[model samples]
Target: MKKYLLQSIRLTAVLLVLLCVVYPLIVAFAGGFSKGNGGGEKITKNGKVVGYALIGQNFSKPEYFWGRPSAVGYNAAGSGGSNKGPSNEEYLAVVSGRIDTLLKYHPYLKKADIPADMVTASGSGLDPNISEQAAIIQIKRVAANRGLTDRAVAELVVKNTEGPLLGMFGPSVINVLKLNLALDELKK
Candidate 1:
């Protein structure tokens, strides 16, 4: 019985180490290879890399289409929502403050023109994409700021907007990094 108990303990330790440490390390290493040497490196133009696609970033300028509100301020390690219920005072305050800020920044727009994504932080808080409607909502502001025609900006937005994955999963979304890069390219 003593020998059997010792064998079981050794087996459990081995399995635990394999599952908790070795497996994850192997998977992470393999995934790193798939992403190339730079891993999370952002693609660039004019020798300037702008941002990563996996992380959300602030775009407060009128010339750029803004991404969703990030609860952790786009910190990938801190990916998570506020987890506040709809009726929570903190959540309501945040939403209200965002709306006010949006209004202040875009005084020319009516209340209805603002997209919900503009005021809401996404679930992961590190979402790099925004809804198509959110991108559309900022078209006029960005176009005017960049001195581009609305049609041109709209076309660019449409081009950057990615469709549902596998043509059936997830919503149509736009990567802010890619879209902003395209916008910068237009100026060059």
Candidate 2:
């Protein structure tokens, strides 16, 4: 019994060090090679910091493409979903409201044509990218609001569209923040 007790203590200590200390150190070291160097990727506008690349932000104005709706109100510190299922009454109402608002801004878009990502908040409520279809659907509203041609905005959307990982993993998506930044540059 005493020998077994000693063995258990030793194993526990080893696991604690490996899981808590060594694992975190390794992850931080690996993150150093990533875009933000262990921090969130910083996006800049007019040479000033605006937001992070991996997080979502609100762009309610008609002149910009909207990102996925965020349940946490785009608050990074409290990122999460609404925890409501598709059939939930409140959830259905929220989706309906989003669809109505979208239609008000873009009366030309058919109800069935609106992509799910446009009206639904992502699971993490922090998805920075939207489906290419969602971005394309909003092009007309943005172009008209910004006094730009539909062709030009569509081209920008095409230019910003990111292909699936390894050419086959996920659906094509466009980073809304990056797309809006490029659109602003085009205006200038």
Candidate 3:
């Protein structure tokens, strides 16, 4: 029993150093190699930092593609879901309102046709990407509002889509900010 206790204590000490110290250092070092060098990937326009590539922003204009609904109002400092269950009345009402808004902007979209991500906030609440279907559903509205052909707007969506991880895992997603930035750059 005495030997086992000493072994367990030593193992705990080693794990603490590895996990609490070494792991964080490795992660921080790796982050330095990322696009923003431990910060977020900042997207710039007209020599100004417009937004970060990884944080969601609210885009309510009909001409822009809307991102996922945010529970914390897209506040990166307070990233979280609503924590409301599906059956909760408030949650249902919120989703219904989102559906109504989508239908208002996209009269052709049926509630059944809307993607889940379109009406629901992601777990992070600050998800920068939306499913491909969500972007596709708004193509007609965006084209009509921007006076661009549907084909052109659809091309933007395609161009902005980020494929599955290494092309083998997860579904495709579109970064809404990048897509909108590209849209703004399109010749009207």
Q: Count the backbone clashes (under 3 Å) in each candidate.
A: 0, 0, 0
Ranking according to lDDT, highest score first: 2, 3, 1
Model 2, range 1-188, lDDT digits (tens) per residue? 99999999999999999999999999999999998788868998878989898778888888899998999988888889988987899889999999999898889989989999899989888899999889988999999999999999999999999999999998898999999999999999
- Candidate 1's residue-wise lDDT over 81-182, tens digit each? 877888899889989998888777667777787878888888998888888988887888899899999999999999998899899998898999889989
For each candidate in turn, the TM-score is: 0.84, 0.91, 0.84
RMSD of each: 2.6, 1.7, 3.0
lDDT of each: 0.84, 0.91, 0.91
Which residue pairs in candidate 3 have backbone atoms (N, alpha carbon, C) closer than 3 angstroms, thus clashing? Answer: none
The residue pairs found clashing in candidate 2 are: none
Worst 10 residues of 2 by lDDT: 53-62
